[model samples]
Target: MIKKHLIYKKDKWNMLTVEVNGKTLILREISDQWGEECHTFLSRPAMMHWVEERFPKEQFEGSEEEWTAIMQAFKEV
Candidate 1:
């Protein structure tokens, strides 16, 4: 059986927990920014710099707001 639960951790983050059989998939909001400029100006080095300088994470990192802004500047297909 597959069960889905929608959970909100905060205003900018969410958790979608899905269970199938005995397996669980935790799809977190992790990062929200996934737009145009991100795909354009942000390279791996740039991203690493931004993540390191602005956001610190134990496991994950990056500026979700930047992603959002870039995404807003572009269109999703």
Candidate 2:
């Protein structure tokens, strides 16, 4: 299961922290943006296209299924 902690943002991106097992991820949403929390995942070939376009240097990790579930959970928020 993923555990989350809400974080306050002051002139910064809103943050949501999700921890699975012992791994922790900080998902950020820009101020004024709404939707699921933000987190990082290793970008796949197709995903890398956009990841690179927006965040060329962003780092990604985790299995394919793990990422899928994470995204789904974000949508639930």
lDDT of each: 0.33, 0.44
- What are the clashing pairs of model 2? 27-38, 42-60, 42-61
What tens-digit string does per-residue lDDT give for candidate 1 at 3-71? Answer: 433322234432222222333332223334531111112233443354344334433343676444433
- Tens digits of per-residue lDDT, candidate 2, 1-77, equal 66554332335454444333334444454544675555554423333343345333234354666455545454443
Local lDDT at 33 for model 1: 50
Each prediction's TM-score against the native?
0.23, 0.27
User: Largest TM-score belongs to which candidate?
Assistant: 2
- What is candidate 1's CA lDDT for residue 67? 46
Q: Scored by Cα lDDT, where does model 2 land?
A: 0.44
Q: Name model 2 segments beyond 4 Å from true.
A: 1-59
How many clashing residue pairs are found in candidate 1?
5
**Top-lDDT structure, candidate number:** 2
Error of 2 at 73 (Å): 0.2
